[model samples]
Target: MADWASLPAELVRRIAHCLLYSNDLDCYMDFRAVCPNWRSATDDPNNSTKLRFRPFRWIVVDEVSETHSRLLINTFSGRVIRKDLPLLSKYFVVAATLGGFFVLANKEPPHPAVVLTPFTGHMIRYKAAVPSYVDISGAALSGPFTGNCYEQYKAVPDSDSFALDFDDEEWGRTFVSMRLAVASGMCAFDNWQTTVAVPPLPLSLVPKISYLMRLYAIDPDKMFSDKPVTAFADLPGTGDANHLFLVASDDGEVFAIIKLQQHLKVFWLDNDNRSEEVEPVKSIGDRAIFIGYRRCISVSANKFLSIVANSAYYVKSTDSSLAIYKYDLEEEKEERVSEAIDSLNQGRLSFAKPPFTIVQLLSSYTVNVRESQLLEMEKLKRQQLPSVPVVRGH
Candidate 1:
């Protein structure tokens, strides 16, 4: 038999990429641990930093109504890993975005958001200056922190915090609709940076298309471009801004999803500058689409045998019931997946703080503060708050 360890470096890395591509993160970790030569062939991620080929398809609910909350599910494989994250009891998932990035906010008073990458076990708490409120949307890091160095994103154990602000273009004001900008605010920490921005839409678009979905690729600097900018290609029919979703395909094609009273419509949006166009589509062919609060992601079906291609998975919620349903594009119907939320590894979670996820990935980035340590710091922050005194009434 040929020696496996002596395999070519390029071949070994390709195998690693294959595993990550399938969202078999656990298997990838084991593959790297086989030997030092194999380990060095692949790149690991800092829990919070977004890097290419990192698997983050797992999901976490904001608040835990039950002990065993459905933790992570492989959308492709139908594999579910359910466990109770005690630390998340006080927080709720505000939005589940692409790349496994979740916008989480406190369930208690003085609500603050922790944009977390559950698998990497890292969170960035943003400090918003808005009075009595913190908007957790608009702009954020386009992609996870990626570079040759990991130390650049290390968080401070306790005092590690980020700040936000809104000012006139005189300082750094952008030529955008102040109303829309303020309505959909951005929350980027001081250390973490964002590359995408929501540009104002034109009056000609209000009746024809929905508000533009914020995704990477649009340069924020272009807001000041001398040439005319088409910002976004308008579809023929109008869609509810809330029901619309934009996701990129594995091959980099962007798809827009519009959810209606009975079925959902998918459209192909081309990025050509000269003829920016939107075409209505019938089927996804060999891929599955996953849509969350205001986010959508498309993945290849061949990667996992269990995922139903030409379909989309979305939440069907009402005043009394909530469930995840699969929308078949080919069949033109929607059906609920049985046990969309189920269990897997239980021992991986830590009650002390959010185990966020138990499938730990190897990363060189140091975790400066675990959730356990931050508990005290949170209390300290509360203690340090200024106490307003009342003046004596005559």
Candidate 2:
């Protein structure tokens, strides 16, 4: 009989590619672990840019356990990868996660912050003032360093000394203060850092005018430019009860997600015209969105078939514990998925060290898969391995 383990290296690579594309992180890892040759054939996700995939692995703090260790869990596969951090005891508060790096800040005074990649154990320290909040867009990090508010309203100084009425066009055009509301998240597309902000509320005394949202894009390199800032799109603002979230789809489309009391409203940013507008979206095709303080991510449901498409997965906090729920966009309904025991009711558990940030794991990385169907695929593949034909030497 032919040796099944003796499959050609090229064939093994093909198998690894299939597993990677399936979004089965656990299976991919298993494939590499089969032999030294297979391991060498597969690319390391951390170093390779070609094997990028949707983030399925989450870096979360395991507060429920007595060890207080940091864990990397694959939501699809249920595999838990744990890492210990002696520094976590002193710097427990996670400020942000950007470009696959975690920014951890010390809780006490003389506070210092460090950027770390949990999987790689790479660390960099920053001695500057710790930001109240931090956001990562590609390689750039942005947050309020000097101010206390993430979103603030500042009056525009009237240097001309003209008592222009709010109704005047000049007041509307020049004096209209820039009302900046820092977005819940940041996304990068075509080298532009994009975020959504609430446009300055209309100054008219009349009640007919409505609040509108502005989409802002900046080139991180230039910092300042003479041209008027590009307003990528305009979104119709709902009442005060609604909150805005920005997320990027796997295909690089930007979406504005508004969270109400019970349901979520999603909008697609359409920039075909000079005046960009947000179109209300009832469905997200084959994608599912995960939003919380930890990270905001959108993954393809087709690749990870176990997770339902056009749904929103979110975390909610109760008196004693924190629970995760899936909100169906098509059905306009919500169902609970998992609940973690946390007596503090802080709901502070994140995929990474900092409390609120996004983590994007490339396709080359492996995550645990718990679903029976996914496991069945691997079992079937092994069963189908061709038996070697018997040959007798004369």
Candidate 3:
């Protein structure tokens, strides 16, 4: 009989190294339990040469355990990937970004926060922890993020303004008068640094007009130069915009959308223009926009039968209830939100923090929901491993 357990180290390593498109990570956890020999041959996920940011699309299902395990649903294929991350058992999925990273935080005394790649088990300790009082709404990256594995990242929380920057991580705080959430479906990681400039001075109202006209620099560091002093006086539109949300499409078009009552004005922001007033855009192709929640994103809805293409979706919390809104971009009218998405919140989506919803479950968990089946990661584990070894002494 062939000596299966004694396969060549090179062959064992090669067989376990499954690369996705040769540019990203694939089923990495399964090989670790294949056998003693295979586990020895495979590289640690953190130090592996094969790992690259693949930009996997996923949605957190009905619930998130306080620690240990989670169920993630693929946004496109609806396939489920169950991840056993003990690092995340105590954290909340506070914020997310287009780079396929989930920013996890806990509001307890430790106040720990970390960046996690759910599928691959890549972890980065953050420099800042979420304050027990402030709620993190969303996060944006300045450049290609390589969150260090050393001490917590150097996160700078802005007490004066709402914006929080931790190295390249821009976490959006939710309790301010004005909020900004940035995300792009495309590979915007290449040029996101040039898109987060804030005018040094406060925005002057355009009298009764709802539109904000600004010629502010794309970099906040350029505030002392010469444009921010007279930015808001030459504005268009009428009355104060109730809410403002920004999203970048797959083609790299960044839009700042403002809401006044039921009306929404979409402005095409030119990242290259150092200081220029933005104008309203009439079209944004077949993409759908999402904003004003735990995270904000834009995706193509051309394939969905029920999801309206060229539309926008948002979540708003009133004194009475939390409601989701969908607005048509072309017609400039509000549409009905999907029911399948309505039950997803589970008190996790809220305006308060340090006490965002948290629940406890078994050390083991499973879920495969939405447009597909509720699969068990345990089932996947069984398929991958020949047997579970009972070795002792660490």
Candidate 3 ranges beyond 4 A from true positions: 1-86, 90-113, 126-153, 156-241, 272-279, 303-305, 316-322, 338-394
Winner by lDDT: 1
Q: What is the lDDT of residue 237 in candidate 3?
A: 50
Top-down lDDT ranking: 1, 2, 3
List TM-scores for all candidates, in order.
0.49, 0.48, 0.48
Candidate closest to the true structure, highest TM-score: 1
Q: All candidates' lDDT scores?
A: 0.43, 0.42, 0.41
Writing each residue's lDDT as its tens digit, candidate 2 over 19-44 gives: 65444454555555555587665556
Query: CA shift at 392, candidate 2, in angstroms?
Result: 99
lDDT of 1 at 40: 73
lDDT of 3 by residue, 218-314 (tens): 2222211112111211134522324444565544456776655566778876655544456688677876665542234554565444456677765
Q: Judged by lDDT against the true structure, how good is candidate 3?
A: 0.41
